[model samples]
Target: MKITKQNIRTALWVTLSVLLVTLLLQNSANVNLRFLHLRAQMPLFAVIMLSALFGAGILWFARRRR
Candidate 1:
């Protein structure tokens, strides 16, 4: 196949995805978290994903409000 910008972008994305999965797998350990009166334990990756979603939700809400 001929080399193209789109192909390169797709390859990069696939590589990054593989790397991300590897990283998550490597960090398969529970962590303790507390928020105000709430407390829980979860895997590192789950905590990160939840934080990202929370940030994105806040950002989206702020942008929509403006």
Candidate 2:
């Protein structure tokens, strides 16, 4: 199989989507997040997705500045 930039990007996106779906389906329990003096309760999937998005955003921002 030939590997190209588009192919690599597509593969990564498909892999991430599969992982996200698997995690969402397997995690159904509610989770509590404590940050310093703050607290919040949300579904495990939501928390995971939010954290992933936050991390991605930080990476994108850092990359853009370089």
Top model number, lDDT: 2
In candidate 2, which residue pairs clash?
Answer: none
For all candidates, the clash counts are: 0, 0
Instruction: TM-score each candidate.
Output: 0.63, 0.85
Q: Which candidate has the top score in TM-score?
A: 2
Question: Model 1: per-residue lDDT, tens digit, 1-66?
Answer: 999999999999799778767877787799999999999999998887677579879999999999
Which 10 successive residues of model 1 have the least lDDT summed? 47-56
In angstroms, the error of model 2 at 59 is 1.0
Judge candidate 2 against the unseen true structure and give its global Cα lDDT, from 0 to 1: 0.93
For each candidate in the order shown, give its overall lDDT on alpha carbons: 0.86, 0.93
Query: How well does candidate 2 match the true structure in TM-score terms?
Result: 0.85
What lDDT tens digits, residue by residue, belong to model 2 across residues 1-66?
Answer: 999999999999999999999998898799999999999999999998888899999999999999
Candidate 2's C-alpha runs over 4 A off are none
